[model samples]
Target: MQAVLNAISDPTRRAALALLQGGEECCVCELMTRLNASQSRMSRHMKMLQDAGLVIGRRDAKWVRYRRNRDLAPEFAAVIDAVLAAERPLEEDMA
Candidate 1:
């Protein structure tokens, strides 16, 4: 889907997806810390992922935790899997 393409187009968002694909909900603050991003920056990135249906966030007390939407269409799911498998090298370089 076009939304899936748009969602994974950003390196940061793809990294976020990599984290979320691990099957645990991650806090927005934690994502910002890992990404070295400001709160607003993380929020904006997350909003894009959310709109694309690649992720979903829920209020958890003061923080919103996000995780990948396993309900994604099969085509999109395949893309997420590909990103996870293919982008590890890039993540290591970023580190």
Candidate 2:
């Protein structure tokens, strides 16, 4: 879909989703630290992914944790897999 492609066209956003492909939740802080990004910037990127329906977020205390959306068309899942496969190894999660 155009939305998915638009959301993922940015490398940073793609990397964020790739990190989440493992089916585990990660805090916004964790993603910020791992990606070497600031809070506002990471938040904006997360919003884009959320808009695309690729991920979901939950608020816990002072943090927001995000995880991949479980419901997806098979085609979208394949696209995610393809991106993960094409991208290089991810940086360690430093948060």
Candidate 3:
């Protein structure tokens, strides 16, 4: 519960998760663009999510793409799904 709460506490992290909900893995550059944040800022939020076991990142040819860490915690998945479902106008995903 604490992990899930902490993971969603930051709007940046929530936006990152929202972007990832589109079913496409996102590279750091893409996230930096989409989130309109500095590389360091994005990386820092990503690290928080990674530490929370909410996201997984993998390197590919100099790019690091991130996606929801499905294998780490099923409970976290349910929590994310529920929150997203209850939230209206899931529009931040486009940004």
lDDT of each: 0.88, 0.88, 0.83
lDDT tens digits, residue span 1-95, model 3: 78778988877888898888867799878999998999999998998888888888999998888998868567778888777666535554645
Best by TM-score: 1
lDDT of 2 by residue, 1-95 (tens): 99999998998898899889999898878999999999999999999999899999989998889999999788998998887776654433433
Clashing pairs in 2: none
Candidate 1 residues lying further than 4 Å off, grouped into runs, are 93-95
How many steric overlaps are in each model, in order? 0, 0, 0
TM-score of each: 0.89, 0.88, 0.83
Per-residue lDDT of 24 in model 3: 74
Regions of model 2 farther than 4 Å from truth: 89-95
Report model 2's TM-score to 2 decimal places. Answer: 0.88
Ranking by TM-score: 1, 2, 3
In model 1, the worst 10-residue window by lDDT is 83-92
